[model samples]
Target: MIRRHMFMSALAATVALSGCGGGDKSTATPTPTATPTPTPTASPTYTAFPLAAAAEFNTYSAAISYTGDPATSAVTLGAASTETLSTRVRLATDTAVATGTYVMRENTEESRFCVPTGQTCTSTLVTPSAVGNPEFVFRTNDATTAGKFSQVEYLNNVVKDTSSNVPALVLNRVSYASWWRGDSTAGQKRLAYTAWGYSTVYTDMPATGTVNYSTLTVTGRLVSTVGTTTAINKVTGTVTMATNFATGVVDMTLTLSTIPTGGGAPVAYGTFTAQGAIPVGQNQWTGSFVTGSPLSGTLAGGFFGSQAEQVGTVFSATGTFGGAQQRLIGVVVGKK
Candidate 1:
C-alpha cells in the first residue's frame, strides 16, 4: 500500500494538510425518524371540508341585545332613561348582509313613554324593502363569538330624544344554527351548531309605565308543499295606538304576507294587534272584525235607506277609533 503522509503549509493562506494511514469512511448516525415523502400514489380525496364550508349559503337569523344610557335633561325624567335594544338579522352566506330592519310593534314597552304614557307600544319592520325611509341603521361591533354567535355592531340610527327617558333603537345581529336535508337525508333536518355565531335579541323599545314594551309579537304560519319546494305563508299583525292623553285608548292592527318571492309562493305571514302612542305628527288608528260573509248578499228590496259598497273577496274589518267607526280594507291579488 502507498505510504500515507501528512503535510503543512508555511504560507499565510493558512492552508493545512496531514498525511496519515487511510481509514474507512466514518459511520453516519441512524435517524430516529424517516424522512416523510409524498408518495405519487392515487387515492380518493375527500371533499367533506369543502362541503361543510358550503353550509354558510343558507339563510341565517340572529337575536341581539344591548344597553344605552339615554341622554336626558332634568326636565325629561325618562328622557335620559335606560334603553334596551333587540333585533333580528337575516343574511345570505358570504354576501354582505342584505336588508336589516327593526321588528316594530304596536305596544313595545319603550314606545309608550316615547309616544306618550297610557299607550301600548308597537314594533314594525321595513319589509318589502320599502319602508320609504328607515328609522335606524347599525354598524356591528367586533363582537366575540362563542357558539351560534353572529357579528356585533353599534346601532347609531335609533336614539332616545333629549327630552325622553327612552332607549336608543338598536340593530340586532343574528344567532344562527344550521341543518341539512336533501333527498338523501330522508326528511331529516341535520342540525348543527356553529362556533361563535349566534345571539338573542329584544327590541330596544322606549315606553312609559302603562302599556306593553315595544316589540314585534306577530304570528307566522308557513305551509309548504311536498319537498318544501312550494311554500305558502300568511302573516297578519296589528299595532294599537294610544288614544288622546285623556282617553287613554289605543288600538291598531297590521297584516303582512310574504311569498319569499312575492307572487311565487308565500313562505310566511304575520299578523297582530299593537297598542301605543302615535308617533309625533301621526294619527292613531284601530281595527276590528265586523260581521261579513264571503258569499252573502241581501235583497235590494230590504234596503229602505241603506248603502253598502260591493265588498271584495278579501273581506273587511271595522273598529271604533276616538268614538268614531273606522274601516280597513285589504285585497289578495297574487298567489295565497
Candidate 2:
C-alpha cells in the first residue's frame, strides 16, 4: 500500500549517483573475472561521455533511506525482543506516477513472515519510495578502456576556457527516475538503491533556433552504479535524453590509436559551450550559450525556432582533456 504523508524538505534522494553521471566507455566489455587492465594510449584532447557519459560517475556519491516496511514481509508480533523480521522493498512498486494523460505503472516490492514457533506465512507489499540527487558531469573515452569505471573524466566547470566564459545564469538542470527489482543482489544483501537528480545552471538560454543536421530540446539525466568502495551494489543502466542543442558543438569523428584498462584512464577537462543569435523584437540582439539541451516537441506560443550562420565565421567553442586519451565528436552545418 502507498501512503503520502508530511513533506520532509530535510530529506534528500536515496539513490546514489557514482562519478558525475557522465562516463567514457569503449565498445569493449571488461572481463568480469580480472580487474580491467587495458593499456593507456594517446587520444584527442576534447572529451564527452559515450551515450550519457561523464567522469563524475567515478567519484560522485550519496546516501538515502525510508522508515517503512518494504512490504515483502509481514510484521509478526515478537514473542520476545530477539525475533527478526524479514522483507524486501521495491521503490517503484510503491509509487503512483502520473498526471492527466499518461499513467505508467511499474511495481516494486516483496514480503515474508515467520513466527519462529514452527509457523510461517508469506505476503506481498510495495517498498516505500525514496531517492537522492547526484553531481552531473561528462567525460569521454578513447580506443582503449573508454567505459570502464575508474578515475574517469569530468568537466572542470570551475575553470573557464579563454575562448568564451560567462556567469552561470540558469545553471544546468538535470533530473532522473529509476526502478529496482526485488531479486537483485543489492536487495538480497540488505542494500537499497534509489535514483534521483537536479542541477543548478545559469540563466536559461534563449533558442538560437534550429539548423540543418541539428536537434533542439532541454531535458537530461544522470545515471551511474551505486555501491560501497569495495564492490558494486547496483549496476545502473544508461540515462537516455534528447537534446537538439546541448550547448557547444559535438565532434563528428573520434579515432582511438591505443586503449587502456584496469588503471584509471586519461581525461579532458574543458567546457561544452554554444550560443545562438535569435531575432528578439526584429533586428534586436540578445543571446545566451545554451544552459540546457533543447528538444523539439509540439507547437506552443514559442516552441519551435530556426536560425543559421555561415561556416568558419569565427563561431568558436572550447573544451578540455582529462588525460591524453580522450575523443570528441563535433558537427557543423551551413555553407562556409
Candidate 3:
C-alpha cells in the first residue's frame, strides 16, 4: 500500500508540472503577422475643351449691337456697329480673366472706337460642358461706355455671340499664325512667323460678275525648329480660284515654287499641285495633293473670313513632308 501511494503521488506531481509547463526550457517566439498593403484610390477625371493642337492663346472676333440704348437704351437690329476682340485664354483650361483689344465700328458711320485708347476690358471662361464647350463672359469699362457686357458660348471653332442685341452673333476662332498678320508693329512683324510658319494665297472675286483668272500670289515662310536649330524658308506659290455663282461651287488650285533647303541638309522637297472645292457661301475649303517623285505626301487646309475681305483673311494648312512621314502645319493671312 505504501509503494502504490508513493507512485500515485509522483504521477500527480508530474501531471501538475506538465500542466504548469515547467519542463520547457524556453517559450517559442510568436510568428509576426504581415501588414496588408492598401489599395490605391483613383484620381478624379476632369473634362476639358477639345483643342486641335497645342497653342499658347485662343483668339476670337465678336460682332456686338446695343439694343436697349446706345446712349440711354435704344434697341436696334443692325449693329449700330461691330467689333473684333482678342484675349489671351488657354485652350482647355478655365481662365479667370483674359484681356486684349477691340476695334469697334458704329453703324452708319465711318468712325471707329478702339480700346487701349485709355480703356480696359476683361473676360472669363466658365466650366466646360460635357461635350467640351465652354461658356464665357466679357465686360469692359470706359468713360464713354459703362457696364458693357457680352456672353459667349464656344462650340468647336465657333462661338455664339450673345452680346448682340439682334440674332446672336457668330464668331470663329482664328489660328494664332493667322491672327499675327494684323500686327503692324515692326517687332510684331519680325516675330509673326516665330511661333509657326504659314503660306497664304488669296484673291478677291467680284460680288457679281465673271470670275477673273488672276494669278493669286502665295507668300510667307515655312518655319521649323529641331533642338536648338531653327529654320525659316521663304514660301512662294500661286493659287487660282474658279467660282460658279450659279452652281454655288468654287474650285481652287495651288502650285508651290521650288522649296528651299534650310535647318539642315536639303530635304528632297518636291513640287505638287492641289485642287479643292468650296461652296459659295462657305469659307472652309479642303483637298488633297500628291508630290512628284522622290517625295510624296498630302496637303489640306481651310480659310477664315470672307474671301472678299482685302485683309484679315486667314488660312491654315497641314501637310506631311519627306518619305519619313514628317508632319507640318502653318497659317497665312491675306496681303491684298
Candidate 4:
C-alpha cells in the first residue's frame, strides 16, 4: 500500500534525524567596538574674601581734584580729565550667595595714594548667579607710586532681596582718578580722590533723639563737563533734592540736561542751586553752588532708609563753560 520508493525512504530518514538532535544554528554578525574619547577639565579660580570696616556698614569717599597741567605724565579720568566718584551700595552674604574676593578698603592712615599700605586690593565679581549689570574691577598696585597704578570702574545694580532685614540698596557707580607722582606742585599734584564702600552686615542708625521734622525728596544721576570742551557730559535729568529736617537745611535743584554731539535732541543744562548744613547728631550734609554757571563746587551726602527713606550724594565743581575752563563730578540716589 505505501510503495513510492519506500515513501521517499521515510522522508529521508526524518531529515537526518533532525540534524542529529541539536538544531537551530545560524549566527555570524558581530564587530562593533570603538568609543573612547573624553578629557577636558580646567576652569576654576577663586580668592576674594577679605574686607573689613563697619560704620553704617559701608560708604567712604575722598575728593581732591582740580590740579592738572604740570605732568610728568599720568592723570586722565573721563572725557579728558574731569574726575567723578559716587557710591552707596550694600551687599551682604555669609553664605546664601556671594563668592570670594570683592573688596574696596580704605585706611590711608595719612599716606594716602589711593590704597597703598602694603598694597592688596581685589575685585573679580560676576557671580551672584549673574544676570545683568554686574561689573567690577577695582585694582590697586601702587605700593607707594613707582609705576603708579590704580583702577576702578565698578558698576552695580544688583537686587536680590529674599525677604530683607534691609540690605539691598545696591546702586553703585564709580570711575576713579588719582595722581601725585612726586612732582607737579599744585602741591604735588593733588588729585587724590579715593572711595570705598562694601558690606557684610552692620546697619542701624536713625535715633539721635528722634526728631523727624520731615521734608525729604531726592533723585539722581549727573556726570558733568561740556563747555571748556573735552566733551564729557552725561547730565541727563533729576537732582531735585530738598531735605529740611527742621532747618538742619539742605536745598538742592538741578533740572539738568544734555545730549548733542551730533545726536539731535536734549540740551538745556543746569538750574543748579545748593546749600547745606546738618550736623548735630549727623546724618551728613554740606553744600555750595548758590547759583550755577560753574559757580564753584562742593556738596556732600548721607541718609538712607529706616525712615530717611534714602538719599546719597557727592559733587565737585568748577566754572566757565563754553568760555574755556570747566570741571565737574557727581553721584546721587533718591526716594521719598
Candidate 5:
C-alpha cells in the first residue's frame, strides 16, 4: 500500500509540472534579417583645360536646341533637330580666356560680335559681318565663369599632345549653347548652337604595325534635349579598342544618371553599349547601339592626341521615360 501511494504522488507531481508550463517550449516570432541599403558610387573628378593661343577645336558632333518656330519672326532661335554640322574654330588671343578679348575665327570666315571678353551679350538682330556667315553672340549662363559667357569648357586633361608645348583643344569639351542670327538664303533667322565633341588638328597619327592597345574608360555628361528644353546629367563608362590597329574595332559601354540639382545622391538613368570600326589612316569611327539594348542610339568617335593617346565619342539615344519618349546626346573622352 505504501509503494502504491508513493507512485501516485510522483505521477501527480509530473502532471502538475506539465500543467504549470515547466519544461515546456514556447514558439516565438523570430526577428527578420534586415535588407541593407546600397551605397551610391561617387562622381569622378576632372580638370578644366583653359583656352590657349592657337588653340583649335574641330567639332565632331553637335546638337542644336532652340525656342519657337524657326520660320517666323516670333522665333528667337531655330532648332537643328536633324542636321549635324562640323565647324573648325580657333581663338587668336594670348591672354586668359576668362578675361581676354579674342578674335574668334571659324574655318576661313570670321563671325563677329563686339561683346566684351567673357561677357554675355544681347543685341538687336544684327547683320552678319560676312554676307553669308552666321554671327554668334556669347550668351551662355554658366556660373563657372562668374556668370560670364564662355564658348567652351575643356576638362580631364582632355587635350593631349601637350608635350609639344601647344595645347590644342580636343575631346571632353563642353560647349554651351549660344545665340546666333544669320541671313540664310531663305531669310533672316535666329539660332542657338551647341557642340558635343571636338578634337585638335591632328599633326600626326599612329603608324601601322603590330600595335597593342589598352582599355580606356571615359567620363562626361549625358545631355538630353526635348524640343526647346535641355537637361544634362553625369555619365561614365568603358571603351574598348582593338588589341591591334589592323582590326580597328571599338566598343563602348556607358551608364547615364539623373543628378539632383539640390545636391544629393545621383539616381541611375540607364546603361548602354555601342560597337564600331575605325577606318584605316582615319581618326573617326561610326557605329550603332547593340541590338536589344534598353535604348536605341548611334555612336561616332575619333582618336585624339599626337600619338592617338586619347579617344572620344558622341552619342544620341532615345528611350521611353515618364510615359514619354526622350532623346539623349552626350560626349565622352578618355586617355591611353
Candidate 6:
C-alpha cells in the first residue's frame, strides 16, 4: 500500500504555499528563503536471493507492515503498492539465479515507486531451469524503526491442460508474512500475513482484425465465501483486448452475465462490467469496475496471464456485495 506520508507531505506543501507572498518586502538585499529539508518517507526494502538450478520461472507474493505510525515509517509492496506483486519471474540464463538487490528510496511520483527515476533501484539475475519452494528476507531502513524484516515464501508447480499438450505454470502459490519490532522497548508484533495463488493458463482471444483485435470467452466456476457461508455459481464472460502492438498498449473490457445468488428466493446477481490494461509483455492486468443496475458496489482486481496462451487464467477480486455491504472476496479459475 502507498504510505500515508505522501498525504502529510502534500499537506505541508499546501501550508508553505499559503504562508508565502504575504511578508513585507525589505529595501535591502532580500535573503533567499532556505529550502526546507525533505522528510524521509518509508519504502519497501528487499533482500536478494539466488535462483535454484532447475527453476525456469517463478511467481512471488509478499506483504509488509510497520509498527507505531504508518505515516513516517511504513512498509509496502514496491511500485504496485495497491496490488501485491504476483509476477512471474523468467530466468535469463542456464546458470543458477544470481542474487538481486533492491533498496528503499523516497517516493516521488504516484505510479513509480523510487525517487530520481532510474537511479532508485538495481537488480541482477542469473537463470536456471529448476523448481522448488524458497524463502527470502528483507530488512528495512527508516527513521522510526530498525531491524525490521519481511519474509516471503514461494511454491512452484507445473500443470498441463488436458486440451493441449503444452505445459504451463499452474497452481503456484506465494505466502508473505512478517513480524517486526517498532519501538526498542516493545516486543515484535505480527505485521502481515497474506497468501496468493495463480496459474499460467489463461483465456485466449481469437484473432479478429488487422490489428489482431481479439475476444476471449471464458466459462468457469466462481466461488465466494462470506463469513461462514459459501456460494458457488457458474460464470461466463468475454474479454475483448484492443491492442496496439507497435506501442505495446492493450486495453481490455470485461462483461459478465448474471450470477446466481444461491439464496432461498433464487435471485440472480446483476451483470458486471470492468476495464483493465495489459502492460507490454507483463503477464498480469488490473483494473476496477462497478456492478450494474440492481446491484451496487465497486470491484477491483486483475486477471493473470495473456490471451495468446491457452494456459489456465487465475482471477481474484475483492469488493462489497448487496445493500448490506457484505464484504466479499472471489477467485475464479478458468482452464480448458
Flag regions of model 5 displaced more than 4 Å. 1-52, 64-85, 88-95, 101-152, 156-244
Write candidate 1's Cα lDDT for 65-86 as tens digits.
1111111111101111111111
Candidate 5 collision pairs: none
Cα lDDT tens digits, model 6, 1-336, are 356888888988888876774454645678999999998754322211122222232222222222233323322211111233333221111121123222221122011112223444222111112442222223333435454332221112221111112122232221122112233322232222222333223233323331333424333233333443434444445555454434444343445543565534323444545444445445454444444422222222223333332221233333345522222222222222
For model 1, the superposed segments whose C-alpha errors exceed 4 Å read 1-185, 190-221, 225-254, 260-270, 273-336
Cα error, residue 169 of model 5, in Å, equals: 12
| Candidate 4 TM-score over all chains jointly | 0.26
Query: Which pairs of residues collide in candidate 3?
Result: 67-75, 68-73, 68-74, 69-73, 69-74, 80-107
Sequence-dependent TM-score of model 3:
0.30
lDDT of each: 0.22, 0.20, 0.32, 0.42, 0.45, 0.31
Please tell me which predicted candidate would have the highest lDDT against the true structure: 5
Q: Which candidate leads the pack in TM-score?
A: 5
Cα misplacement distance, residue 326 of candidate 5 (Å)? 1.2
Scanning candidate 4 in windows of ten residues, the lowest lDDT window is 46-55
State residue 212's C-alpha deviation in candidate 2, in Å: 11
lDDT of 2 by residue, 17-61 (tens): 223333435356767887788987543222211212221210011
Regarding lDDT, does 1 or 3 come out ahead? 3
Q: What count of clashes does model 6 give? A: 9
Weakest ten-residue segment in model 1 by summed lDDT: 300-309
TM per prediction: 0.20, 0.17, 0.30, 0.26, 0.50, 0.30
State the number of backbone clashes in model 3: 6
Local lDDT at 105 for model 5:
48
lDDT tens digits by residue: candidate 5, 211-291: 323444443443444454444444444444452356777766665566654567767766677777767777677877797
